[model samples]
Target: MSGARGAWWARIPEPVLDAVVVVVAVVDVLINLDDTSGPAWAMATLACAALIVRRRFPLPVFLLTLPASLMLDIVFAPFAALFTLSERSRDRRLLVTCALLFAVASATPWPLDDLSSHERAWTLVYFFYTLATAAAPVLLGQLVQARRDLARRLVEIEEAREHERLLHSQAVLARERAQLAREMHDVVSHQVSLIAVQAGALQVAAKDPDFREGARTIRSLSVDTLDELRHMVTLLRASGGRSTELTPQPTLADLHKLVTTSGIDAELTGELPPDVSSTAQRTIYRTVQEALTNVRKHAPGATATAHLWHDGDAFGVTVTNTPPARPSLPLPGSRQGLIGLKERAELLDGTFASGPTGDGGYEVRLRIPNRAG
Candidate 1:
């Protein structure tokens, strides 16, 4: 019971176990001694006393006290020593040596005389008994060691799975944060565009040429500010694909314009649904624009491709790019553009996805319902 490991309650304290060994040795010495041989009993008792440290220095205690067995046959100390040695290292050499010593000593005819020398049959019988006695501790030690190994491996696997779960949780949190950024833009960006359009109207209405020029300047500044805000929102969203394509430089229906104007080498194909709402069209436009921007930032000279089409209940935009044409700029990217695109599509009850292609390139795709309603 004391030998079972991996749980605290199964153990016996070392000092108590040592005390038990000492008491047993004393009793053994008392029982085996002849009534006239007080001095010999005292000497044998001293040798067996070494069992008190049998678990600590098992081999040393076993070897030093083995002679005590020659006088009265002390079994506990040697058995405990053998068990401890096998438990610690599973060393074959030490186990075999201890077993051989026990076998030889157990078979030896004591108080040497000619009658004892002739008892070969008795010697063989005692040898087998001692060998089996030596084997019991070894088998038990191996069992305990095996159990301990299994427990350790199970603990490691659990920890590894816990680490993976934490990583997955962090990834989800990042996506939610990106979605929040896109929502913020949705709330504020439209007002800014309205202000820019009003400034342009003011420029056209002014009669004095100098006053008209001032209004024109104001309008220009407002437009520029709106563009910058959109850029910032796109970067924060990580879903922003191409900022350039998204900003309505061309009509939303023209997918070819998005691929051509983004400055990345790329191709465009497919037709848009004629009845698509302006809202759905804008979402697809921003998606393609963000994809192109991502290609420019991450892939540099890589060729890009765009496919715009209508999928039954939804309008789809797919943008893909070849691997980078040149070494990347050392600058880090915000990835807001991609996130913003994803947020835009989802808000319209659509889907968005992006990943690497098999040939080391990248792809981004978005789908939105044909009508904002």
Candidate 2:
């Protein structure tokens, strides 16, 4: 209940709070104006007015209230100023000095007159009493300041915890993706590869024309399916964004073998520089692999040509395929292969383009700077 009230009190506007403080100080000064002189009245008025700017100039405002404290038996003006000073000032020495000055000003007689030794002792006793009393506001102000600091620190610690939780969630998701990729590669891919190999053997051994043709179709579709599965597995394994490899990455050296096993009539021509980086070689291999797979699925009975060449400051591969001699079989596809290839090329500071040729053929091209990895 007290916390709620404090929060509501904090919501009050600064100017309104300042005005209320000034009015309270003025009332305190008026109550003690019974036998005070003109100078006392003037000092009291100045002190009340000075409260209006106490927050902006705490030390100076506290000094202005000292004269009224010395003459009039008023407590609000000086205490208010002292509290403001203590709340704002971080220097312990300055606060101690201010508190001592307030104590001396309040305890001393207005006129400097000769006093007996006993009277001087009594005055010394009054000064210590007032000094102890002045400590209340100072301690309260310091407590408030420490509370504000602790609140800010708590907010920062909460934000740090929230960020740590988000990172932990991402780490869990990456591990799950890695597990899924392993299942697809080890179980699903192996079974599909066996089916493709069996279909190829049957196509060669079968004597009936229709049976051989059906077996060839099965082998071609199986190969295409396996290619897509490999791309998906690669993406899932790399989802963690780490450099560690879970499988042997293909490079330009494997290009000939890829073409031979593609289940399509494809020819690889030309060659890249032998000094090409491993990353760039892998990119080239994937590009050619995806293009030939597209040809097999979208352009049945089409012959494809993959040509690698270097020109000026760039080097890349271009895969072009003749138009399909027969209608393509309907195949399931997520259609993200080309998008993935385009993204991969962009990562290497390269470009990818694919469209139909003027002769109704399809062409896909990838280009990367010679200096790119």
- The pairs that clash in candidate 2 are none
Q: lDDT by residue for model 1 over 1-373, one digit each (tens)?
A: 1234636744778788778767776776667666525545665766667777777777887776566665555676566666766776557787788878876765666654565444877787888888888888877876666566545444444544575487466556556656666775786677777877887898889899998898888888878887887787766655432322223233564667667866667888887757777667777777887788667656756898888777667778788888874445345668787788888877888889999999999888887775652
**TM-scores of all predicted structures:** 0.48, 0.61
What is the per-residue lDDT of model 2 for residues 1-373, given as tens digits with 9 covering 90 to 100?
Answer: 2353379778899999999999999999888788778999899999999999999999999999999999977889999999999888778899999899999998887765888899889889989988998999898888777666555445444554675587578777777888889999999999999999999999999999999999999999999999999999988887743433322467898999989977779999999888889999988998998899788667866899999999779999999999986444455679799999999899899999999999999999999998795
What is the clash count of model 2? 0
- Taking all chains together, the TM-score of candidate 2 against the true structure is 0.61
